[model samples]
Target: MIVENKEFHSRICVDALENAKSVFSPLSSEEKQLLLEQMIAHEFKKGEVIYRVGEKPDGVLYLVHGKAKIAKAGIGGREQIVRMAGVHSFIGYRALFAEEESYASATTLEETFLVQLPFETVVSVIRSNSDFALALLKSFATDLRFAENRTVTLTQKHIRGRLAESLLLLHKEYGVGDDEQTLQVLLSREDVAKFSNMTPSNAIRTLSAFAQEGVIALEGRAIKILNIDELERISRLG
Candidate 1:
């Protein structure tokens, strides 16, 4: 559900840009203001595809609220979840910088808000602001490292370890709910399977097994970690 683009001065749009200050912290006040003035804000409903694979990016997207997943379509139309983006995260910039079509799609996990800095503006900043360019390079490096680590984990880890690590990864990204136990992000079993690199049925059975082992408690889509230490141990052993 994409909303009509809003002016930067609109309250919601302003708030969204406020949440993304860290990304522009390297810019001077005037440059930051100019960038924000040129940004366009968009809202997407849960399950909406933000961008599809092979689409050309027009701008760099900054996730201001809610969650999103970056995924690539696999065999039989299955999607492999490559990365999860939360508030203050950037998406679509890699393709923009590389001048290539998006290799993966981005979808909203919940009602999401984002601000897009135009491609020309971003390129201008990168050329003029040395610190900003370096910061983006560092961010790229960090993402590469995480992808390399996840590739190893998904390929080599057993089912139990994979599931456990996926849950931990969710916790790290979204933190706990009000009870400080239930995961804040609610995902379907299939989404979990994609993220963990397993079949949906296998993910279900392993989740049930973990519940039986007193490592986690499940209520609908909410997964509560009952024993963090045990969960970590299983992930480590694999």
Candidate 2:
């Protein structure tokens, strides 16, 4: 959506600016406002590529709204989705900080809104603020830890264990419904498969197995947990 002349400093812009601080903390009040002055929100359509692998890094991008998936194409042209991001998530910082090409492709899994920070200002902020530099280090370190856990899940776990863990992660990321059962975000079988490191056929089969075993209840895109305790047991056992 285009910014209206009357609402240039709209609440959304102010909110996004505050959030920018969480990602780039070295920004002083004056500096943040200055960077905010340069920011313009961009909307993305569903299934659009925000950036592709091997492209030179330019700016830091944050999801102001919606979801994105980072994926890589493997041997035989199979695409493996590595991560899913939601509103307020940090992305594209690795390549920007490293001053290299992006290692993975980022695409909109749903319609998205983003706030892009100019590269020149990013470098300046990092240089001027020690706390901001530490914030970046902690942020990247947290991401690395999550990535490491995901690697173990994909490489070591059995199919059932992986799916159970994937569902738990999704629930943790989104939340359980008021019933304390259904996953908050609806997903296609293929997307679920990608997150669980399985094929679509395997995802479907395992979901069915879970349903029959009273591990979960599935109705179309909605999944409700029948026995979260058992699910946790499976995740732990894996």
Best by lDDT: 1
Score each candidate by Cα lDDT: 0.86, 0.81
Flag regions of model 2 displaced more than 4 Å: 1-10, 19-21, 24-27
Off by over 4 Å in 1: 1-9
RMSD of 2: 2.5
How far out, in Å, is residue 218 in model 2?
1.6
- Model 1, range 51-166, lDDT digits (tens) per residue? 99999997888888889999999899888999998887789888888999999999999998887878898889889999988977887787889899999999999999999999
Task: Give lDDT: candidate 1, residue 93.
Answer: 80
Q: Report the alpha-carbon TM-score of model 2 versus the true structure.
A: 0.88
lDDT of 2 at 75: 83
Clashes of each: 0, 0
Against the true structure, whose TM-score is highest? 1
